[model samples]
Target: GQQVMQIPQYQHVQEGEDFTTYCNSSTTLSNIQWYKQRPGGHPVFLIQLVKSGEVKKQKRLTFQFGEAKKNSSLHITATQTTDVGTYFCAGPPDSGYSTLTFGKGTMLLVSP
Candidate 1:
């Protein structure tokens, strides 16, 4: 069976600090995708990395893919209230098809 793991079911940060969360899996994956859901909102695709050791960033947020493609991490620099959301890391099963196994996610809360 395939499984994905995410830590820190919740996170709290001030208006201007850094935050990070990690994800790992028991088996190798062809690719990994990230999604973010704002409070009372649906998950929206943020990014996808398919190559081993790939790294990508958007503004203050950075994403990394492990060499084995069995793990990944997301780092956010200079947090803002607008960044508040649940970050989900997901990967497809061996059978594939765009169907994803999602981690429970790390919920971020920011105080003004």
Candidate 2:
């Protein structure tokens, strides 16, 4: 079975600071997806990476995939109170159905 894991389970930052989270997979991934869940809200898809050493950015956020395709990272600049949420990374395993396995998630809290 394939597994996705995230580091720094929790983070607290002052408003206008920065934040980051890392994700790793137990097995090679065909693709990886990122999501953000607001406080008490459902997970919202952010982006997906398929190629090795790929990088993508959305406004103040940046995402990267390792050249080995076994790890990934998300970085946020100038964090704001609106950025408080849990970030997750998910990917399909090498076996069986197409269901995705999600990482434990990194929780971010921004204080004004």
Candidate 2 displacement at residue 70 in angstroms: 0.7
Give the worst 10-residue stretch by lDDT in candidate 1: 92-101
Candidate 2 lDDT tens digits, 13-72? 999998999999998888889999998899999999989999999999999999988999
lDDT values, one for every candidate: 0.92, 0.93
Highest TM-score: give the candidate number.
2
lDDT of 1 by residue, 3-106 (tens): 99998899999989899999998888889999999999999999999999999999999999999899999999999999999999999854566678899999
TM-score of each: 0.94, 0.95
Our model 2 lands, by Cα RMSD against the true structure, at 1.2
Give the runs in model 1 whose Cα sits over 4 Å from its true position.
94-97
TM-score of 1: 0.94
